[model samples]
Target: MELAIADKITQKPAIKRNVYENVTQQFNKASDLMDLDPDIRKILATTTNEIIVHFPAIMDNGRIEMFTGYRVQHNNVLGPYKGGLRYHPAVDIDEVRALATWMTWKCAIAGIPFGGAKGGIAFDPSKHSFGEMERITRRFTYALNGNIGPEYDIPAPDVNTNSQIMAWILDTYLSSVTPQERNRSIHIVTGKPIASGGSQGRDKATGQGTVFCIEQWAKDKNFDLNNATYMIQGFGNVGSWAAKLLKPFGSKLVAVEDHTGAISNPEGIDPDKLAIYVKERKGVHGYPAAEPVDHESFFKTKADIFIPAALENQITAETAPLLNVKLVAEGANGPTDIEGDGILQEKNIDLLPDILCNGGGVIVSYFEWLQNKRSESWELEEVDERLRKKVINAYKKVKNTSQEFNTDWRTGAYIVALSSIQEVYRTRGIFP
Candidate 1:
């Protein structure tokens, strides 16, 4: 279906390839391996809608600046479109499309009754003032007025975005609806502040879920979690919370690399202290307990586990060879590209694929949505217990699928997701 278009410009191959291509490659492998139904494959191959909005917002200095925002609805056959909205400089159509597609697979793997969608504004949140950020967030919400709804498309928090941003979006959306619908519409978004209907333990859900999968792996391998050493990339919510949650299991954080710098402390850098330091210094650069190290040194720091909680394509062919870990628990989406994936398989590095490993966030997001809709609020302990069960179940499913197909965990995850979609389409049949 390639259309005749304008002449294309040729350039050198990129070291860090396009994220969308990486995701598509992963999908193609699973589709081929399983002999996926052609009709369902076609439906899953493309997005339902791609919305790019350009709007103006008033800056703190009284100047109106234009911002480009995107929301790609990948699929909604299972239920509604559910994913996160991240505010990062790297936000673009291709990246959002990849993220949206991953969400589809993620939810399907987790057995959550939600499809996939993702959106974000392409700008640096750090450079913006509070007022400016609020105006930008609300403006994006207004621009997406009818396109998003509680039961239709629910947006959660992602990279550089948090409960506060979700709060702003919720308020803006509730105000736009009819007065009678305001109460019912509180479920329009997840990851809201607790007082605003956010689920308890939602803040650390992703990290909790990552640790749960790691625990499952440890049990399967007959390895103990007590006093295990690990390294992490990215000091944001997911990485920090994962480190903190692992503390109870006697897991130690040995080395960490963030955007600011990489630091290592063989004696173990305290997760709580590092978290506090990150909040004050805005990065992990000047932690007094750890020594600053180069990228190679950080990757080479011998440890039992490696968690890449940063951006996409981080563990490429070059970086993959340097990793010295038994397992990789991806707290972030698409952290490993196709080449790196091959390298890891060659090295026998057990991988907890992003879809199965980092599904806690969305699973908890589903909990939050259910709570809001049912007019219920769950306690922290209850939330934690429920998340543990859901994530472990998903972990078992992925492992079983991998074994059944004699394929990698990533492909196993994809097969699980594709099968779910295919079953639904087959049972219901396509619309006329």
Candidate 2:
């Protein structure tokens, strides 16, 4: 999950189309082009498990509220189900299913030992107090029961979720297990704080990975990053960090948008300063340094790169044409709709698809899990190096696959994911 990595920056989707349908269209296109194995295609099209739980939690107002939560396990043939659990109002069965399927593809393309799963509760976390949030998280974890485990389905933090929430989940899960199994189960969740068995670079892994892909793109296009202009949507973990990281490369951040509002400064906006403002104000709507702008103006801001690090379906047919960018580096899952993808392709805009771009989050999550499982900690530099190598390799694979198949990068990413799984199925065969 290339998560917003903070409070979810959600709004009415840019388009009214079904997200699952969009995802399926992408999947079918790749499957058909690659001549994917029929049986595996059938198996991959549907989810293995869909768990929806209604659990009651005590609110800060001393009243109990019934919260609906869902966990969809799409496929686990590669390894355990791994994905982020989010807290958002629009989390439904279809959305979770789509996200779970994307995780399957993301993990496969990245060559990670994990399948796909996505779980989330449908509610805004901001309306609740800290105690209410904790209670809700714990209750959600308990509601999940044994569906989640260190080796079965490891959960990570997504939108409106962070290390502290993961910590609460870790504790709640451990309390339910036997004392003998507790120590070994620390790998049950990733994105925890350093003291809680998380990896060194898990916090910024997604952003770092996105930047790595951008760097690869720059190298391929012979484009210099110095004095390049970029606009980011969502001033959360992925967007904020990408800005800061790109700033050192001499890229100027001219525009930013979030759930609160969009803001822009054509000359440049200091990511560090904007981040501090967001932390203080919880949004970019009123950042002192940048002037507020309407959504149209924000998207129309011309830049070399546009990182849609917010919600999915943001770049629909309606908004796609408004973009004045040479490249779209997705730092969020399903950010571009099918129409949007077609528009970008026609516009000759290069897209580093989400599966290939956001692999950093899960790759580092894998590292965190490994570190916890072995009770060994890796240094920050080592983690960064390994992440860079894996992201670049995946980028190359996707690029070559796109060229080989003569298709869009999105389709190429799906084909790469499907091909890897196809090989595994052929080697292992079906069970009786």
Candidate 3:
């Protein structure tokens, strides 16, 4: 059964889209709106550094396989470079560049002291055993030795990478330094196990932050979360956490679609139970709580809110028209393409753009970094409180900007971020 599941996971259809192009397109739209300085626009348009590495790792079968990895630093004017380390077969330069650029905007909108960077290894983590994964991760970390650090560039987890992978990275990076520098260097990675200096609420920070944005939206619109039905397009960390946290607000997760399959229950599905089933079964495919649905039906399912927590370009021009929801809270970066954004706007479906909607993860990541830097551990309650305050503040800013410009949420978010970045550049001026 597990083998069958693994095979199913690996058989996903190919999705082709230039994510970097998407980022630049959005940037150009916001830049035109704000009349951004052409010089600064040109500077922000390109990456600061693009590091690619190829290394060999021994598999459990004693076969040596070469792997490729990338770390793209987009900008660091605000602070040190910060982003996630993803592991996926589709990992490439364009995707990393787009995500890194998004991180710059995300951190700026969230008012965090960090710039943008992203790293990824182009391999399917599920195909490898624990030992093989450890070797590959350690080798990748070694390859990125000087490029990543506590005060320079920090890597967190994204997509197929998780806390365990981050733990490997933290250890491998620490092993290269002296004993005196070991404890302080644990900050090199943010999403490690709590025992390894990770923040208490880091695991659910992204999801919790998503819910906070939704809560603020609900409050402003006078929409009651109680009895609201939502469909989630991914059941991974962010999606599952959002569902679980929304349970308290009486939100019903009526439908869910993931890499494995889609399922729906009109009455409601228990997010906690489904999350457990997914953990054990590797997806939401075999969950008995909901009837199986196809991709089209999953999106067309009548619901109050839709959260695309899956990979990029899921909600495209084609899928946008099929959606039957009032709000879309982007849980994944770049889930909605440019055309889809226009379609959603035409449909009057309010959207919480990815940069603002998913900014919680980085905001909390900033908190974790501060905790490690200051040699302090915060309670989960404190972390949650801080995350709530920061996320709400960002949401308010985006909302105000949207109303101020009479534009959609995505452009509004970009304008807010670009204005902040432009202010910094104007104040600091360019270096020789």
Candidate 4:
């Protein structure tokens, strides 16, 4: 069965559009171009399973609130379902489905043996106390029981979630499993603390991987980073680190935006100072150096490159037309929807697809997974080198494919990923 049909059967109506729909649309476009078999395309479009769990947790206000959690297993044809676990008030099954689908393509682009899946609980972690957060994570972990395994589905960190949440999940899962299953506890999850078997370089792996790709892209395009002007949307881990790394290249950091608001300075902002302020003050809104700007007007800023590191759907068709940047590096998943992509294409703006662009995190997660399985620790320098090679190779493959097809990078990326997935399906054949 095609994946899309399966998705329609499983998905409920009146829900926010599945983020994967954007992914599926891109896949279908490439599938049509390739004249792929309908059945195979369908199989690739839908998720294998979608698990939703609702549980009650005591709130700090002495109220028992029913929190809903979800895990969508998009595919396991390549390997285990590998993605991140998130915590946010707006998390829903559709979002997980979309995120899971992106994971499928990301791993394929990296030439890694991993499928896609994503899990999340609908709650604002920032509003909860530490004890409350732990309890919520533990309960969510408990609900999974034995459904999650190192060889089945592996979850990392995403959105409002982090390594601390993964730690709680690991402990909860370990306590619930049998003694025989406990030996492989470390393998069951990635993004834990170093002492708890997390990979040494996992913390900065995503940002570093992104830097490697950007550097390589600059080299291939003959674009000098020293003269490039950057406007980043999202000052979180990925954006902040990317800014810091690019600073040494003599790039001008023109502007940056977060949930609080956007801030800009045409002369360029110091990444080190911005990092310190964001670290100490929690956001970049109150930084005294840069002038406060309205978030709505951020798209109009003229710059060489715009990196969207925030949540998905930030740049729609409406916003795409307003963007004045020459290049867009998607540091977030599904930041550009299909319609928005069309506008960007019409405008001839270069777009770096999320599956290939922001895939550093999961690629590093794979490294983390391998380290745990081998019970070995690698040096940070080694980790950085390995990650750089992987990203560069992946970028090269995508670039070559784009040239071969004479299409934009986004379609070329889809073609490359879909071709791999189609080959996998053809080799596996049909199951009874």
Query: After superposing candidate 1, which stretches have Cα over 4 Å from the reference?
Result: 1-17, 53-68, 87-92, 121-136, 159-161
Ranking by TM-score: 1, 4, 3, 2
lDDT of each: 0.90, 0.90, 0.89, 0.83
Q: Score residue 241 of candidate 3 by CA lDDT.
A: 97
Could you tell me which residue pairs clash in candidate 2? none
Local accuracy of candidate 2 as per-residue lDDT tens digits, 277-380: 88999999878788889999998999999999998899999999999999999999789998898999999999999989988989999999999999999999
Local accuracy of candidate 1 as per-residue lDDT tens digits, 1-432: 631101010121464246657667778899899899987887787788889999999999999999999999989999999999999997887668767887898899999999999999999999999999999999999998899999999998878888899999999999998999999999999988889998998879889999999999999999888988999999898999999988889988999999999999999999999999999999999899999999999999999999999888899998999999999999998899999999999999999999899889889989999999999998999999999999988888889999999999999988988888999999999888
Residue clash pairs of candidate 4: 2-42, 2-43, 3-42, 3-43, 3-45, 3-46, 20-98
**Clashing residue pairs in candidate 3 (N, C-alpha, C atoms within 3 angstroms):** none
Off by over 4 Å in 3: 1-16, 54-68, 88-90, 122-136, 286-289
Model 3 local distance difference test score = 0.89
Per-candidate TM equals 0.89, 0.88, 0.88, 0.89
Q: Write the candidate numbers in order of decreasing lDDT.
A: 2, 1, 3, 4
What is the C-alpha lDDT profile of model 3 across 179-288, one tens digit per residue?
99998887898887888888888778889999999999999999999999999999998999999999999999999999999999999999999988999999999799
Who is ahead in TM-score, 1 or 2?
1
**How close to the true structure is residue 174 of candidate 3, measured as C-alpha lDDT?**
90
TM-score, prediction 4: 0.89
Q: How many residue pairs clash in each candidate?
A: 0, 0, 0, 7
